[model samples]
Target chain A: MSLDASQFEAFSASELAFLAEDELITILPRQNLSRMDFKGWVQPALRALRRSEVPLWLAVILKRQDRCTIIYPNWLDATYLKTVLEAEGRDSASFAALPYMWQELSDTILAEAAEDCQGSVAEIMRTLQELKELRLNKLRQGVLVNNDSHLRMDGIGSAELNLVKPILSKTMRTLQTVKDAQEVETV
Target chain B: MNLDLESIINSVGRRGTRTRAEYTTAPAQRLKQWWVAERMAPHLLEYQLDLLNEVITNCRSLRDYIEETSLTLLDEAAVESLGEETLRDVKIKLLLVETELERAKFVARAYKRTRMAKIDLLPYYYLQQQESQSGIMSKDEWVYCHHRTELEASSYYKGFLNAFPTELQGLTDEDGHISMIETPDMDKPVVVRVNTDIGTLKIGSEEVELVKNGVYLLRFSAVSDYLEFVDIL
Candidate 1:
């Protein structure tokens, strides 16, 4: 099989992370460098001790080389995550408006650049786990009760959405066809 | 069944991009759109001939530049004379290009291989489609599809097809009865998001109100015409 078997399915975990790496983030440089063109987009030149916005992939490379420190986004802070966790509980009908790639971005930062972050990593992880559970629970409930042809997925994070894709698509299609058949018989 | 179907049926579908974020679709953005749609779609989609050409050309030149610079740096005479700062700069630039090149290569290879998998599954079915609709396969892909069917036909004849009765030896459906060629199951369910408000779309016996940014689960055939506004997830 010359083909990558992973392509047959929805975005895999690594592939989603690859896509998330394209979302721009701030990183503080330890050395200065001139602007470089990436063909798709251009990254501005960096100066020592200066904060620069670059795609997360570049930041990861720079960080790996001991040339830069990635600045943790505000949403990943323990305080901010607590608030969003509360928001998740308070609103069962919709997802908290997190960045579309919030799960992947936060996970990557914590895994690769945890030392530069300000607070407790365990606390952040716990909060994220709870948030994931709450939303996934809600999604499960939504699927069971939806009965409609469409699933309301606005504000759902990319990781969470992809998690339920295969099952949700199959379940909803079966429900839809059976519902349509029943409706026709009733008429 | 009504006005929407008649007008949109002949219109080709272009996957919707995020107008809210960037109105201009960059090369990367176009590649993302085509890659996702081709993977998620059960059948082969309109081949992205132009986008692949642009990206492949860019990658080829970048690969050449990387090779040229790395070779230059490898020469001890040249590296021994350069200042530390310049050497470090060249190395960092090389690393950046190498990393970015891997990503671009992934997208290009993955996109093409995704289509090839579908083509190899049932080459003759797509070859049949080339007569009615030609845009689905690129010229190279068309040749590949042609060769696969040709190879298969010859292998069939060489093995057991030569010994079979003359009337039963034909591989294709000629009597308009049982279908010897398999086509994609368009009725297969697909998960799609409606990026634009296209009002109510009739799916089966239900009329789905595709509000802006609303996601829907629909049969591939029902929403085939409106894919310009809908994205297969």
Candidate 2:
């Protein structure tokens, strides 16, 4: 049976959570921290030095414990994002090559480590939100322009793909309807 | 088992009412039926059902693998060789397995819904006959029958019962004097096409040879018992 909207939403959210767990985040240890053996990553040295790379889920845990500080990546930097947003001018294609989990990871880090971060979490969140909206708009535009039923947006994570799947399906259906109407008119 | 037509009718009606009520608010409850009737391709349902079973088997195997691996990780030698690449590979595989399990679960739910819908459509007398012939009733069918009886006095259930063959009514003799049909054994021997070499299997007293790309008939019981070894065509 066709999955209803709510069922689909739940499925998408769960799949997104699984995807977001693998996303990498840089963290700076405030003190020497022993590595916790988990499924996702290679076990680091017994004592992690000042800086270490960890999955977003682990980073959030470390941040919550005040064990480390999250390092915001260059792409997530306010100035850099603003520049890309301006240059791309609402084109998702340019941003398609960007990290798939960038938005989700940034938002998560901002929420988890808002108190520990040096800058305002709200400001970074705003910028990230804006970038996400722009990218989504571009994705929608791409879907409308493409005739194929499948909308293949490279570099989009499973979470993002699930989020926009319904919209893409609807767009494809609308396009089909329009094409049918035009053919009938000509005939 | 003796067939109770009245009880069966009542249960069917009860179930149909409950299902109808549930369907009003949550059509997803009938998703499998909808998928079968509208979305599924011809013969795809059988494949999907097989795929669902395969996925379940894989999930169980993966779980066993994880448990075994975790125990191995406790070993000093195993821990030492658990390099970054190995850990990453395992994690990726586990993630893929989990995703596949989730998809399989969705398929399974849809499949169950379709079966329930089929049982709902069948009249109580027909369902009873099927149970008698098969010597078994699926749990879903039992539940459906129980619910149908709850709606027994309703006009809807009466309408369904009325559509059954008039001659069949005489077959439900309350005195236990109804003659039993000599139905063929369900465990009768059947032929199967071997897709892959499965070596040999013991069917009753004989050791049956199974060659790759070979066709042979064997008892249904034996074939079902070793379904993984051969494909039933």
Candidate 3:
């Protein structure tokens, strides 16, 4: 996820985090505050003990300041992730569905607001690690059988896709060039 | 509220194949899409002048708001000296405003840098072939490209190109089958996420079912025509 000179086409880890910060998350405010105009959209005023929706970045800031606690998104729940992990194990050919920015979002929650999460933090982390490894293994296997003209990447999340981006694009281009040369030879 | 840029950009909803008309009016999302598209596309896309203007206006308004509020805070401190809770509220509001402004500024910088990277590639080619991108180069972009092209051509000439035959001194020659001009590789493979059901689209010798949200690796030329429905990953 680190940016290098040759990897300009894709987003870096920090850039991905910046993009994911826009994702909305529900938070419970600890104090009453007036609505904030976030330039584009207005964040509703926070009332003590009441749940309100705010972008993940704002939620993280407030959480750090002890003004709010973040409610975990449904997909990030431990029980839900357990099922997703099992599904990835169930299918070796395809990946299970996850949000596009799941990697960055989950990392932020775990790092900044673990106390506000509903489930055991360690268990969620363990499940997430397992899911990451299993999907990566499946992708490695998929590469063994990748064809020249096109490849199907059905359920690869943005983070996972980004990690394999350089190799994936290079391999596809090389295979394409070779195939085109062979066709020219045949003609 | 998932708020993924994809859903937000496509949320205006399509009545059929007219997705182009539904480009989201949300300034942030528009700027984001422009940035991402510029990064992803094989060729230079149209200059998003309207979107850039909107972002500039928004940034100015935010700066004014921040400055005015800060003065008010200072005045209150000088005269009344706000109590504990009131001061905290004001500080938090100010903090949020500054952070959002920084985020917008980051987007603005990142967007310009992304285009600059592309513009630096074959600047003279794009200058001569403006029609290829529908002449979407902004005035500043034009000046930059022209200056870069001149600098690059002059350096080459000084270093070595001056010694070549007079006929061979010409660059950007499209006379032969193998043109001297540099162009983006349209046939290059790119990853694309289908925003809508584009049905069956052909890729090389293969046909792919581009179902909504399905990802595939295909040539840029094939996906370029469906920019409204396909997001290059």
Which candidate number would show the highest TM-score if scored against the true structure? 3
User: Which rank order by lDDT, best down to worst?
Assistant: 1, 3, 2
Best by lDDT: 1
lDDT of 1 at B107: 85
Candidate 3 or 1, higher DockQ: 3
Go through the candidates in order and give each one's C-alpha lDDT: 0.78, 0.49, 0.77
| Candidate ranking (TM-score, best to worst) | 3, 1, 2
By DockQ, the best candidate is: 3
Question: If both were scored by lDDT, which would come out higher, candidate 2 or candidate 3?
Answer: 3
Give per-residue CA lDDT, model 3, range A7-110, as digits (tens).
Answer: 45577787788888877676777999987665665665677766666678888889988999787888998899999999989988888889888888899989
Better of 1 and 3 by TM-score: 3
- Could you tell me which 10 consecutive residues in candidate 1 chain B have the lowest summed lDDT? B11-20
How accurately is candidate 3 docked according to DockQ? 0.42
Off by over 4 Å in 3: A1-5, B1-25, B76-83, B131-134
Clashing pairs in 1: none
lDDT of model 2, residue A77? 65
lDDT (tens digit, per residue) of candidate 3 on B25-85: 3576578877877777767787888877887777888898889878988795543677778
Q: Which TM-score value belongs to model 2?
A: 0.42
